[model samples]
Target: MALYFFRISQGRYSGASDQPFEFDSREAAWTEMTAVCSNLLSGISRGLRPNSEWRMEMLDERRKPVFCIRLTADTLD
Candidate 1:
């Protein structure tokens, strides 16, 4: 097993898991990250403001980035 970290940023909100998750492999970590992203996307089902961006970053035990997923929202009048 390996230790993994997850952090997120959206507009003025940003946070990370205080405790790391132990997963069997990187694929498993990716799965968990997607689940988290799904939950966050649900919150924006209503709508998003112009120039809004959401990011989910996965880090290793050494705090090095492993992978990142981004979602951007824009509105034009």
Candidate 2:
């Protein structure tokens, strides 16, 4: 197993997981990342403003970025 961390950000607000989680495979980490994205989007009403972007960064045990999922929203003016 490997240790990983999830770092999330919404426009100007950003935060990272306080603790590490163990995963047996990279695919498993990706699965969790999607779940986090779903949770964030479920609560998003009109989407993030002033930036309209959100992201989930997956980091390895060494605190290095292994992968990322970024969401961008746009509106027709």
RMSD of each: 1.9, 2.0
Q: Please give the lDDT score for candidate 1.
A: 0.86
- Report the lDDT tens digits of candidate 2 across residue range 1-67: 9999998878789888979999999999989888877877767635566548878899999988898
Best by lDDT: 1
Q: Residue 47: error of model 1 in Å?
A: 5.3
State the local distance difference test value for candidate 2: 0.84
Pairs clashing in candidate 1?
none
lDDT of 1 by residue, 1-77 (tens): 99998988788998877899999999999999888888878777456677888888999999788989988887777
**Which pairs, if any, clash in model 2?**
none
TM-score of each: 0.81, 0.80
Q: What is the TM-score of candidate 1?
A: 0.81
How far does residue 48 in candidate 2 sit from its true spot (Å)? 1.4
